[model samples]
Structures are given as structure tokens and as C-alpha cells.
Target: MDEQTGSPDMATGSDRIAGDNIAAYASSAHSPTSESMMSGGSRNRKRSEVFATHESPYFFPAHQLYNVVSMDRSTSYTLKLAAKIDRGFFLASNDWTCYRRNYFQISACFFIPGLDTTQQPEVPCLLDYNGELLQVNRFLICIGAQIQNGDKAIELVQHTPKRDKGPQITPKRMPVRAGGDLSPGPTGLQPYVVTYERVQFKTATANNGKRRAAQQYYQVHVDLFAETDTGAQILVANLLSAPLVVRGRSPGHYADNEDDDAVAAAAAAAAGAGAPSGPGTSSSTPYPADERYPPASSSYRNDSISSSNGGDYSYYPNYGYNSSSYPYQSLGSASHMATQDYREDYHYNNNSGRHDSESYPASPLSPSGPHPHAYMTPQVQHGFSPAASGAASPDMYSPSGFPENGGGHYQYGSPTYPQYPQQHPQDQHHHYHQEGQQQLNGQYDSYNGGQQYDQETQDHATQLAGLRIHSPVSPSSPLIGSPTGVTPRRQSFSSALSSKKAGVGIAGDRSSIGSTRKTRSISMSGITKRAPSKTRTSRTVPATPTKEHHSNGGALGSIGGVLGGIGGLGGIGHGVKGLGISSDRIPENPMEDQQS
Candidate 1:
């Protein structure tokens, strides 16, 4: 110490040691401490000595440590992810079995252990391997195929970027009591759960070129990922469901590569053999187990095969049997023969009960043959059979048989049957003419017989004529007989005469007499008479003049008076003059002439 201040150096060294120990203690105190360690340390010390003594017990453990415990860096909590299907039990063995084109349900849940599940503890924030905060709250499910006893896996369906997005759970801040005040506690996020209620697979399990024993098995894979700044994904949590069996359209039947090969072979063979191939034929590609019998076509007549007689044999190739193998005769031999053969075959098949009743008629050769009621028409079903309808030949069966003028005419209306007699056209025409002439002669005789007058009718006619002559408007000629050549049963002539006599002295007498006289006149010179006045007027006539007698111009006055009388008589004279001249004539005013 005297050599290099030894005492002072020793003191400095001790103080440095103490200082390092104190620094170590302070550093250790400031370092992060676990809840359990902190609790143990607190038990060793007094409760009053703790920094947050007035804080609630709930705040002491979780709330007080909230700021100290970084959720992004904490390793105490771990996410336990799991995936399960609702209908995982198979009907046969309680194992999972999925059928193609069917729906199923899948559910996934991720939670932390050692937490009250009922409390719905939040899914704590996570950090990836790089220590970067993970910001993913959703997960996706993928359907993959795994071959039995195989090492490799095949993905059938994968999640898309945006369209196949998953569901997310939002974080919520829970309230808690700290000391004497209410404050926001740790964020609360319910368990991360998502459900795919109607998950369906359109494709069946594929063998992926593996052995038949190594059939396909399906699995549902759930993945959680966080997006990076470059839009890349970082895997966080992943889970896989149990293996399941996916079946094909036929239950319990698994299709493999061998079946596909067999189908391809059949299709190639059909194409080489010139068999019809289309949607219609492809639908029936599933052949039956029995190889001896071919699959039936949708119809008996396909569009490919045809006969020389405009018939259909298209179904022959469609029967899946070789057409050349059948024992059929040449179709060009005869149309009737070919039809008969077809009918026989149809009947044979029907008799064997191999075909349904609706396939064809009961019998094509029925006694009534194929009438309008059945499917086949009469023209196609049967030829002319004389025994059926008692006809001589095909010509005799003709609906219009033969013309009337022809020699061998078959008349339906003829009383005789089978044997129709021939008749001459000239004779028939003559017969019709005779009937018409007889009718005309009868009509003429009726007309002449009706015109003849009987004696009694003639006597009535004379009386009617005499009465007509006395009538003011006498008829031009004597009465003729009635059209029916009948005499009046009630003597209507007498009644007519009495009616004329009663009308003789009426005011219409002069016009009636003039009209009657004019009807017999040959000349048109007839005077029109004026009607008499209501008050009758009298007129005086002078004496006639003599040739030797003369008295103070009395003869001239008599001549003038005679002329005036003649002028006054013009109305009556003119009416008389309208008639033809007669040998005997009546004088006008006969009573006055006799007096003179």
C-alpha cells in the first residue's frame, strides 16, 4: 500500500464490487417478471410495500400486467386449432363417408388453453417467426384427396384470393374495475370459429394413378395466414380433419382408371363399327352386366338403318349387336315379303314376352287387320285378301270399283251381290226419256181437261153475261168458265146481278155507263160528262121545224132550238158514237121525242 497507495486501492476495489452488485440488482429488478415469480416475490415482501397496493385483485394479476405483457410477444398463450365435420359418421361403420354431388358441413375453432371457454377469451395477438405482428383473424378450408396407402396428396379445390375469403372475428375491449375507477381492460375476442354449412364436392375421388387398393380418401385442411407488406402470406396455424371416403354416382361403387379404359375401348369399338354416336347414344353408354344381350335403343327404328322399301331398320345397329349376324333375307326381293318378315319377327318377340305391350300392336295380322284404330294403316299392314271381304280381286276391292258405262261395273246399290249384270247405256237413257215424256203428257192432258166447259157451267155463263150487259160497267165479253172447270155451288151469279142492280142509280152511274160503252167502242172519240149539280136544274126544248110551215120566223127559231138541243145531247151522243155503228139504234130522250 505504501508503494502504490495500497490502502486506497483496496477501498476503491471493494466499493467497485459493491457498486457492480447494486447495478446487477437494479437491472434484475427492471427485467420482465412472470406473474408467478412476481407473486412469489410479493409474498416474501409486505403487501403495503407493493407499488399498486390500492389496485383491485383483478387488476393485480391481469389488468396491472397488461402494459407489461405484450400480446404480440407473449409465449405463454398458444392457439389450439381444430377442424371437424358435422356428419362424419358413415352408415356402415361409423367412419366418415362422403358422396359426390352431396352437401356436408364443416366447422373450425381456434382458442387458447387454460382459459374459461364460457368467458370467450380473445384470441391473443400473435407474431410470426420473424417477430413481426400477425394481423390475420380468418382461416380457410381446402379439400384435398389422399390415396389410400399412398404418400402423395392431390388438391381438388383450393382457396382463391378474394372470392374464397373466410370469416373474421372482431376484437372488443372488455371493461374492468381498477382500484376505484372503471377502465378499459384487455381486449376480448370470442373463439375464432367459422362454419361452412353447405360444403359440396362435384368431383369424385380420383386414384391419381395409384393401385386399386390405394383408392382416394378426402380430407379438409384449414390454414391461417398473415399478409406481409408485399401481399404475400405467412402461415400461422393449420389443422386437418380425419380421412373420409368419397363415393361415385353408384353407391358403394368406386370408379378407377380401369373402368375409364374399358369405356374408352367400347367407344372406340362403336366408332369403328359405324355405330351411331350422339347425345342420344352416349346417354346409354352404361352397358349392363350381361354381355350376351345388347342394350336396347330408345326406339325400334333408328335413323341410320333403312330398307329398300322405304322402311326403317336403324335399330339393328343400335341393339349393340352386329347387323351381319342376323339371318335376314335380301330386302330387295319383294316389299310384301319384307313386310311379312318384319311382322313375323315382331310377333315372335311379342310372343316371347320380351317386349312391352306398348312397344307394338298385339298382332299385325289380326282378322280385322290394322284398322284406323290401331297404329299401322290398312295399306301398310295387309294386302288384298279375297276371303276376308268376299271380293274377287284387288280391283274388286277398289272403292270406286268400275265406271257405269264400263262392262264390269260393280254397283253398291244393286239388289244383287257378287254377280253384277251389265246394262246398255243407250237403253238406260231411253228409259229415262220415256219417264220424262209420260210426265209431260200427263201435264198437257190436265191443262186441256181443265179448259173444257160443261152444260151447267154454260147456262150460268149466259145468265152472267145478260146481267153484265145491263150493268152500267158491263164486261167486254160473256163470262168464261172457272179455271177449275167447276160450276158455282151457291149460284154466286144471282148475287152478283142483284149487287149490279142496286148500284145502277148511284152518283157514279154516268161514269159507269160511259166506261161500259167505251169498252165496246172502236173509236177513241168519247166525251167526258160533267157531274150534275147538287140542286137539279130544269131545261125547256123548242118544237121541231117543218119544211112547208112558216110563222114569223118560228121555223128559224125552231131550227135554233133543235140545234141547241142537239148541242145539249152531245154528252150522250158522244158516248154512243164511241161504240161501233149498229143496224138498230135507240133515240136519245125517247119519251120527249114521242111527245113531240
Candidate 2:
């Protein structure tokens, strides 16, 4: 779109370009500076810069986190856990205060194939955050709250995990370290009894990028169960009742060092005596083997917990502590004494279209490869360009890190593990200082006493700011006057008036029966009025072409600018002639309708 208009380019350009011949715009015969083709330094960067702004706002909103699952018609269920640390914290809350304070909401859109009609299933009171049954539906959930009526919404199917009784799969035991810290080898640990089922989403292909996008989601269903002593259960209840804490441990780390051989021997010994236990075996008291391993949460477990007394237990320091009368309290309950920890991991699909790869532009001062210290590393072969190859130049590397042969810029990598060329500390400081100065000078439009503007306004301002371009016309005389002796400003005013008159002419012309035939042909042809000649050349007394008039290549170049000369005039004239009309056909003076 023209920079002056605050609308999308397609909205404005569609009408003009659709009626005009597409071939005309697509033709390669036009000069380099023609407005039809995007060029010039600022014009090329505008689209890229706007895209960057949309993907990376000045600051991210707390509630704007999003995740997407791809599902097809064959899939009927999907399981999803909150990904972000802050998001997980809110979802793990039992008091519902997090929901109230943060206006927590999750939006999921499902589409299935071949389903004419379906009602949202009634939310069941099945499981609490602590892996216990709710017993009663007391939590306020806006069920089946909103559904889009289009083809995208009706075909969706989703399945949340249910709390159920299953055979408690217990881990084998190995030697327990002094403090449950498994060293390099031979630590006795047991696996917890947790089972997970697959969840799938089924929907018809609908509103994705194109015909290839499926309109459904699918996931594996999972249920986590653990048999615990009163101490461990109390600790589990505490974690479930409060905000989730990612303990910074890997998911597989806990089960890694368990003594599987010893646990197998123990299981064999128990089976010989007929290990009497039913499914969901926590009730059985035949043996006290459950306390051998701490009851920890797993991926299969619903990441929420709650207690019968749902008051503000989180605020109390000793809320999770077991009864003071218990004998183990003297040494602290096994739950409080264990070295158990919680850890959260953020995983994102880098292949998705919406992901941003770089947090900062490339550093101009760096000579390193994407790997840190790659330039100076002795392990890598010496491939640095020699000083004779112009390696010392800051502009040697393109922003994308390939040779600067005027190619397009490339993104560094995903935000999580960005592969950036190493930059010196001084370069980083310079970039930060430049950004700070821009903020101080009001370039960001977002630093007004620390208050934030609306997202829409910020987006609009960003687009506007990026649209600025360096004009080819000089400040001394910006307008290119017509060759027919009319002043440029007068011609512009006349053109504006002519545009208004064309509106009335079109309306009146459409109404008149006599003009219908001509109007129809004109409309179908989409004929535009011929514009005045834009070519002119400076003259000298000896009938010789002035040096200022004829630039390189025997063309009428620009009369005032660097390219100003007679060489440019020929190109412009040739372009004008190619439009199927001559300069003589243009009106000397445009007439406006008397209706004002």
C-alpha cells in the first residue's frame, strides 16, 4: 500500500491492479525505479520489518501465550500440559486465586470430519489436582463456552485424562544412597506405578494455511499413580495444593539409576509368596513396599492437587507437614527428608511457521562462526578469510553470515537454542546503547513513563515508523514538473480535482442510457486517462546535448539528481509509449465538473 494510507496493501492494490493488466505490473521491461516493483532501501525493508514487529513485540503480554496441536479426523483425543513455567504455575493452583488474579483462560479450537452435529460433553467431577476425585462439581468451569459455527469448529474431539484404578506398576529397588543421591552406579531406586493412555483429536481439514492443513488434534492419554507413606502423601498434597515448582531436574534423571536387577529379585521373592494385591493396590497392607520409593508426579499425572479442606493452605508455612504426633516427625517425614525436586521444561516445535529464530541482529564486529569462539578455536580447521581477502571489513559478512554478495538475510535459529555468531563484549554494549538511545529519543513509541499502549496502536505505529523512506528528489526542488510548462504543484492540484470529477462522471455516465455503450466498453477496457509528458532535458547554446542532460548510455538522465540527464528521458518516453498512447493525447488542462 502507499505509505500515506493506513490500510493493508492488498486492500488498496487489489482494486487498482485487478482492473489494470496484471501483465503490465509483472513485465520486466519497466525501469528499475518504477513504483510497480518494490525497490529502494526502505521499501525492501518495510515488509520484513513489519513482520518482525508482529512476531516480536516490544514486550510480550502475560496472557498471550499460545500452543497449537494438529489433529486429523482419525484422531479423537489429545493430552496437553501447560508448557510455560508461569502458565504451569497458574494451572497447578488449587485455591483458584491464580485464575482470578491473572484472568486465566485457555482457548482450544477443534475440527472433526463428517460430524453433522455434536454437543459439548458435560464436565465430570473425576480428578482433583492432587490426583484425587473431586467428589462434587464445585469448581466453576465455563463448559462448551464458545464454539465457532464455521466448518473449523464442529468437527473437533478432545479427551482429558481420567482418574481411575489400575494395577500400580512399581519400580524395582536398588541400593539407596546415603541421602538418595544416586552416584555414577549401583544406586537402588524403584520406578513409580503410573500408566498413560493416548489422547487423539479428530476433525476435518479446515482453516489452516491451505488445503493441506488438518482441522483436528490428537494426544496420548496418561494417568499417574503412586503408593506413598503418610509423609510422602502430605508432601505430594502440598505441591499439588500450591504453585508448581520446576525443580530443574531432567525428566528421566529420577528413574535412571534405580537398581533394576535387585528390584526384579525382590519382585520374584514377593511373587513366590503370592503377592496379594488388587488393582489400584494402595489399600492392600500385605507388605510395606510402597514407602521404598517416594510418590512423585509424572507426565501422566494430571498436574493439579487439592485437599478436602480447600481453604488458603498455601499461605501457611507448615501446611504440607504431616501430623506432629507421627513418630517419623522427629527425623522429618520421608517426604520432607527426601531429595525429590520438581523441574519444568519448555519444548517448542521449531518447524512451525510462527516461531521467531533470532533475539538480536547479527553483530558487525564479530569474526566468529555461529559456534562460540569458533574463529579462535584450535579444534576447527583454519578457514578464516585472510586480511588480503578483506576480512577486516565490518560489512564483510551479510547479516545472515554468508559472504555479503547482496543476498537475502537469514534468521539465526530458534529462540531456545539460537546459533549466533560470537560477538565481542564491546559490540554487544554498542548495540544495547543504540537501542537505549532509540528508546530515549521516542523511536520505540512505547516508553512513556513506563506505561504501555494498546497492542493495536503499537502495531499501527510500528508499521508507520518503518514506512519512512529516503526520497530520490532533493530538498531544493522535490517535485518533477511536466515538460509542457505547467508547474508541478498546479498539476498535482488539478489531478486531485480531476479525481473528484471522475467519481461524478462515473456515476452520471452509468445512469445515462446514451452513454451506456461507451461506458461499458470503457469499464471493460479499464482505460485510464493519459498523463502529461514527464520527460525534459536541459539545453546548451551550441545545439550540443548538455553534460547535465545526457548521462551514461545515451539516455536522458535526471536533470538535477545524480542520474539526471537526457539518457533517462528516452527510457521514460519508451515506457510511456509502450502503454499504447502518445504524449500528444494528454489534455493540456483538466476540467472539473461545475457541481463543485
Candidate 3:
């Protein structure tokens, strides 16, 4: 069904004729019953004067009415009607449209002019054309297309009610009061308020089952009629709502237009092409070959060789062996050559009964057979040949060659090679002992030199020891400072020697010779003695005499006295003692004294 009102061109001839009849009826003068009811006289009543005293029933303009009307659950209806009325009453307008599937309500208030401003302005009673008061119990509602300029009639389209058994036109009746009755009381003289409640439009406006134009418009026509005494219908008051623009059916109802066959065909093709094959089933079509990888040749697969004897195998064509510039003709020839070279250089001998053939079988490429010593042989021997022999041999110094040995080739440590002599354990011991003895003799020689140095040191030290002694006094001589001259006791030789060694003088005075005098003392014996101090008439016995004078005097007196006396040389002792006495008293020679 069309969503809008039908246009003039789209209407059939029958539809146009029907439209003309409707227009004529709507525009014609009031019917005989209506006129009689209004005038209470003849069926043809004269029209009212231009400035008539009585007021007429008419609809208010849309602008003068309240515009805030809405349908439940609808986003439409944002724009509403608003206008001024000449009667000074601001009434809601019914000059707008509504969408299909939406339930809406329309309300209009009727008022009689000439009413007191202080009293209720509502119409207390609806008067007929005859100036008689009448009650309007209900109104008839209908929907039809808007009249065009040249159109003589309005075309009404089919309408479906909301209920199965309800009238084909929704909201066919609208009661003026709740109980559909107007009692003869003050309450019954109520204000006239007409309302169409919860009205829904199921189908859009159309003509002859054709689609609607975008600008097509429809109107809701309301009519109130009263039954005369003769039972004729008299049109009392009627109103036409604003032009309505109805929309088409909702989008959810459009599924019925799709093509099921075409949809099924597309789904089948996609499934067959994209689905994977089952495990038990094989694909009928073989995989297409790609130009990127060419197929392998039969020779490449059959003659492929691998490095290991048994394992997972990967096949590749032998590339360089087939070329003429390659050194070895085949793999087997290369292996055999390496084996033969190893044998000849090392002197492999098969007489040891270890078969070389068993280790390395003959190569297919070398058809004559395996090399005689292609594999290792037990008892491999090595021999050294002189450079002048004119034979190709490995260099003895090379790391890979056999170790060099003198006396020709022989087993390790064998008697045949006698370059290194072997010694008995006892001889090794004796040899060690001789070396130790030589070291001891050297040590003894050094010790003897040290002894000679010590002897010289001791003799010098003895001379220094004598210098520390005081001149000895004779037993028959008087003490130098004694009062009675009672013959001073004689000190024994041992006591005199000890007194000198103890570093003390006979006069109880410490000698000027310090402890280090031993190191400074030098023996002047067997050497020319330094001349004695010049004799002075007033000889101040020199304090701490020169080291040379001290050594000569002390040595000659003390050591000579002891030696001479012990050797039975009394003259020598007397002369030495006199020299000691003279050195302290007068300068004289000990030899002169000895001669006297």
C-alpha cells in the first residue's frame, strides 16, 4: 500500500468520479433535514445575512491551539502547529500529520461567542440552525485525501482496524461524554469537548494499489449529526483535521522481498571451494605445478650419495665430480688414493696377517680392485734413508713423520740402538758421592783462608792487650810513692796478663785504650820500629802516647818478658824488664842492657 495520498493523475476514472461526488456533497448547501432542524420551517431556508446576529460553528486555526501532541514510542512529531484565532480563543490546531503504526490522540475545545468573560467560556449547549439547543452525543471519524485545486471530490482509502472483529476504520466513534448520555441537569449542560482517542493508521494513503507521491497529503474528517423527528440524519457540526503525511511500513517487514534461490546458490559454491578434505577421502584434482621449482631428474634421485652410511636421507645431484677439471674422477678413487699414500710412507706390512682389504672394500669406480694396503696393517714400520739415496720420503722433522732416532730404525729402548748408554744403580750412587766430596773440599779451602785471617787478627789483638797494662814494679824496688818503701808485692805473670786483658792499669786507673783498641792495634814486630819520643830535660810523660809507641813498648816488655822467662833466658827477661823500666824512666835500648 502507498505511504501517501494519491495524486489526480494516478487515480482511475471511477476513482475520480467518486472523488467528484464527495467534493460536491461536501460543498453543497445543507440537506433538507438539516435545514428543517435548524429553521423549524420549510426545507429551503434563506441564508444568513452578511452581518448576522447569530454565531456560526467553525474550526479554530492551528496556531491558536496548543501544539504539544505526541504519539507513544515515536521519535517523530518535533514540529507542531501554532496560530491565532479571530475569536480570541487560543485553541490547539489539527493541521499536521502522523506516522503509521503510531497511536495518537486529538483534542479540540468548542466555545460559544457572546458569553460573559467572568463566566466559563465553554460552549454550554450546541444550538441548531433553528436557534434551538441540542446535545451532541458522538462524532464520526474518517480519513481521506486532501482536495487539490481542480479536484471536485476527496478520495478515501481503505483502512484496517487494530482488532480482528473491530470496525474497519479505527476510532469510528467518539462520545461527547464518558457515559454517552447528557442528563437534563447543570452537569449535563457541560462544555463541548470532542476527542478521538488512541487512533492508529495501519495503511498509508493510496489510489488503485499504486505507490504514493512524496508530497501527497491526507486529512481526518470528523462529523456530528442529530436524528430528526422523521428519522433523517442532520449534519449539525463537522471539522477536518490538518493534512496528514503517512509513512510506509517498518524496515523489519521487508524480508519477504528477498530471493531464496540466489542466496542458496552462493552459499553452496563457497562451501565447496573453501572446505578441507576429510582424512579418508582424497582430492580428485591434482595440485598444479609451480614454475618456481622444476622436477628432479631420474639420475639425480638414483645416484645420490650421503656422508653417513644409514640415517634420514636427503638427495642432491653430485655437482663437481662430473666436470673434467675436477682432480679426482669419482668419490671412490679419492678415498683409495689417500689410503695408498698413507701405506707406502709408513711402511705398512701385510705379513702380520691383518687384512687391509677387509677394512676397505674395492670401490665401484676403481674396478681393478682395492689398493694392496688401502686399509691399516699391523706392525707398520718406519726407516730413515739418507738424503742422497734419491727416494721420495717424508721429512723427519715434519710433525706427521715418524720420530727420529740414531742407529737406524728400531723398537723403542731396544739394544740394537745404543746411542744412549745405560748405567747400574750402584754406579749412579758412587758418582753422586764424588760430586759431594768435591763440594766439601772447596768449603775446607775457604775455611783455611778464614783461619789465617783469624790468626793475624789474634796477634794484633795481643799487642793491643799489652798496651792497656801499667809498667810493672820490681819486688826489690820501692813503691814510687810509698812512705816506708816496704817492697811492693810482685804480681805473677798470669795475674799481670789477666789485668791487662781486663783493661785495667796496675795503678787502679782505667787505660785510655777504648774497647775498639783491638781493631786499631797493628803488630810492629819483625818490622822497623818508629823512633822513640825526643828526650826532653823536662819530659812531661806524654798523655795517651801515639798508637805506634804504645804497641812497641807494651809488646816488647810484656810478651818478651814472659817468653824469655819461660824459656830460661834470664838475661832476656832482665833486659826486657829493664826496657819496660827505661821506657817509663829513660829512653834506652833493651839489647844494650842485655849486653851489660
Candidate 4:
């Protein structure tokens, strides 16, 4: 309703739209995935080639319990909660956002207590991620983490230092305790997160002449976390004892608790009036719940300004989605009674949360049972029960579960958590090359000492020898590439030999070398061979006696022919004088006589 623009204030409507746009634009800016720290924005960290784009959970988990100095009452206290979630790790509108757990990747991290010298405190030194001052190997959960988890459950696993195709480590389910504030309030939720900021008055001062200097201060953005699983919630409870809450500080200055703590408080007051507290245990109450998973309504029941009992809380009951601690005060309501009744349930782990391997004991038989005051009444929930939670069993004590920090607090990659078995930084280093098409180091790739594609070639035809590829070839082979990143064409090499009998080959007979042609050469073995010539031809003229070389000393000659010798032997021939024939009967050929 603008007074000047009589047409019903379009400017005012536009203002509303602009405000919505701004809110939408910045809604997820603070999430751990998108946080500047994980985006290679930290001054202490250099760009990592191993991890080009930042992973979803880029920071490590740091529990305050492990940090002895952080627990001191003199400095500010922080409750860091980490949970495992899916890969994307997007913040959830419900279920207090948590990261998916990967036991293999879970490790403990720690930082120096609050800043003692300044108004604010940071872990004394810079921690890249995980518990490491260096970021390269932070995301990897060492072999020790698996071994530790194995000791707690009935699962066998082994870890190797090199890149070998070995069996993977399969661990048992995480041990989750059964007893806790199943009320869905501060203690029951899986892990609650509320983002808020505070301006430090100690750091503020004004110095511009007496003209009423505007207040100067630094606004501290606080990403608060609280445990949900009884396994981890117990750890949180041991740290926060009693602190009276201040009712009026900076009111909901940031985003209000998405759970609507105020509306829930009014509902609690109504429920309290309707159902008066009795001496009955939580089992008799209508809201029997499992500590791990609680009903939606029961979650914020204790969210009222201040409960009668000062059980652990996420923020100041009265202050703006206030800080974890509050101004001291006394309680006088059923809330106070409730806190007193359930105090004994908080102690799940010791100062270090390590279980004695030699004498691990179930929660029921733990010689070191928590203080008698630290107990919770039995509560029920759908699909779960006290016995079903087997988390209290000694075998389930040490699980490889990651604590989550809601709103991308970087639980897995983000904080200081439990001390995992120490891993040699050297073991985790890996060479990262450009991820496109990689070249084969050797065509004869070997596995377990056996050859791959490259092997010896069989012999070829009789005329042509075969190629026998031995293990080592000359480096000058055409296939070998230098720094040019190029490969030459593959040449076919084989031994070719001349025929053994001129017309023969290993496969079959070959065409005869023409009478004019002959082949001879050396092969891969360096042996030389020559081909035979064409077949012999028949003689045309008769040889003379004088030209003949006699083997028996006499030369066989040809004489003139006589036809009547048989008749002369009968004594009727004219050529024989003793018989009846004369010399005229046997005569030489006239041609022969003429020649004589």
C-alpha cells in the first residue's frame, strides 16, 4: 500500500519478490560442500591435483573429547557431531543433514582447544583435513581403522600396502546403544544442526570523535552440532555437564530452528498440563521410543525455553537459537525431574572411547558402569527395541562409523575425530596421470609372470623361414615410441629362404626357377643356400672310338655288315675256300671300299 503510487504499490510487491530471491540465492552457501574452506580457498592449502574438484565432504571430523585442552571450562565449548551420509552429501531439510558413512574412510581428528589469547578460538595450528596437518592422505581411512573395527566384531579382513587385487574388508554393523533420551529432543535426534552468528562485544570499539560512533564488532558464524546415535551421543553427554541457560541474549538473530522450538515449547507446556508426571518409568509413558530413531513430535519436546532438568541441549533455551552453553540458572519443573532421572544414560565411552581388547565387557556387565545417575528409562519406538539395539554388547563397542556434522560440516573429511591406527603417509601416495586413453606399457603384458598378447611365432613355408619372437627385442623396433607420443606402423617380419631342391617349398612344390634365374641368400639365422639349374637334354651325334675313354683298355668299334656268314658255316658258301665258297661271296659295302 504505497501512498504515492495510487495503483496499489507494485514497488512493494517487487520488494517481496526480491527478498525471496535473495534468500533462495544464499540458502546453501554455508554448507560444507559449498563452504569456501573446502573449495581450495584456505590459505594453508595448495590446489590438489589428485582431487581436482573438491569432494562433497572436504573437511575432517574433530571431536572435542579427544581434544583435552578443548574441554576446559575457561574457554568456549563446541559439540562436534559427524554422521555418514550419501556421496552428494547435500543438506537435508529434515533429519538434520548428515553425510553417508564409509567405515573405510572414517578416521579421528583433533585440534587445539579454543583460542586462549584472542576472543575467539581456532585449533592452535592449521589442519588440512582428517587429523592430518597435510591434506593429501586425509580422506583415506588407514588399514588400522579396519583392523580396529574388526577387533570389535566377528569379521575377518586384511590390508595390503600396494595396489593388488586382494579381498576387501567386510566389517560388522556398527554398535549402536539402546538407552538414551529417546525424547527426540536435543539428545535423541540423529544429530541436530542450527546455523547462527554472534557479534563479539569484547572485540567491538568505536573511535571516530564523540559523534556517537556506530558499534563495531565481528560476527562469528557458528555451525553447531549435537549427537544422534547413542554410540556418539554418549560421548557428547560426558563433556557437557550443567550450565544454567540465559533467557534473553540476541534473540533469533539468524535462521530460527527449523523445528520451530517456540511452537513446540508451547505444545510441551500444553502436554505437561494435560498429562501430569507420575512415578511410572518411561516404559509406561505413551511415547516409548528407540534412542537411534525418535518420533517427529518427541524430537522437540524438551526444546522449551528451559527444562526443569538441565540435560544436554543444542542451544540456550532462551537466547537466540543460542549457543550450546548458557547463563547459569536453577530449574523448577518436570524438565528438571526428567534430566535427573536420565543422567545415567550418557556414558557410552571413556575419555578416549577405546575398549580394552583383553577384557572387553558388555554394557550390562561393564565393571566401569557409568555413574548411577547416568541412566535412561526404557522407551519404545517402531521397528526397534532395547534387545534389538545389540549396540551395548562388548562385541559391538568399536564400529567403523563416521560421526556426521549436519549442514555439510565435513564430518568425514572435515574434522578431528577418533584416533585411527596410525598410517604411514608414504603407503597412500598414488600417481595421477591424465585420465584419457592410457597407453599399454608393454604389448606383452605379464600377469603372475605369464606373457600376454606377444608370443613366439611358428615356422613358415620350407622356402620361407618363420619368425621366432624372443623375450627381448631391439629398442629400435618400429612400434617403440619416444617422447613424441606417436606410434609407428607395425611391420611384418619373417625369414625367406631359397628352395632346397629348386622346385620345392614347405607347403608344396614351387614353380621351377626359369633356366636363367637362380636364387641364393642369407636368412634370420644367417645361413646361405643356392637354387639348382634346369634339367639335362638328350645327345644328337655319335662319339668316335678315338674320342672314347676305355675303362677296360679296348675300344669297341663298328665294322661293315655281312649277311651270308650262316650259309658259309654249312659248307655251301662261296666266300670260304675250305668250304665251297670263295672270297668274292663276302664283300664290304661299296661306300666303305670307296672310302678305303
lDDT of 4 by residue, 212-271 (tens): 222111111111111222211111211111111111122221113212222222222222
Clashes of 2: 58
Query: What lDDT does the true structure give each of the candidates?
Result: 0.21, 0.14, 0.19, 0.16
- Per-residue lDDT tens digits for candidate 2, residues 1-596, read 11101112212232121112211111111111111112222442432221110000000000101111122223221111111101101100000011111111111111111121111111111222233322221111000100111001111111111112111111111000001100001110100000011111122111111121211111111111111211010001101111111111221321121122123222322222122111111122121232111111111111011111111111111111110100000001101111111111111111112112111100000111122111110111111111111111111111221111122111111121111221111111111111212221221111112222122222332222211111111121101110111000000112222334333432224434554332211111001111001111010000111221122212111111100111111111222111111111111111110010
Name the 10 consecutive residues with the lowest summed lDDT in model 1.
56-65
Scored by lDDT, model 2 comes in at: 0.14
Best by TM-score: 1
TM-score ranking from best candidate downward: 1, 3, 4, 2
How do the residues 352-398 of candidate 1 rate in per-residue lDDT, one tens digit apiece?
A: 32332112101111001112111111112122111211211111211
Alpha-carbon runs more than 4 Å astray in model 3 = 1-97, 115-170, 173-192, 206-214, 226-231, 250-596
Candidate 3: tens digits of C-alpha lDDT, residues 373-402: 111100011111111011111111111111
RMSD of 4: 47.9
Off by over 4 Å in 2: 1-49, 56-125, 129-131, 135-596
Residues forming the 10-long window of minimal summed lDDT in candidate 3: 83-92
For lDDT, candidate 2 versus 3, the one ahead is 3
The best candidate by lDDT is 1
Please rank every candidate by lDDT, starting with the best: 1, 3, 4, 2
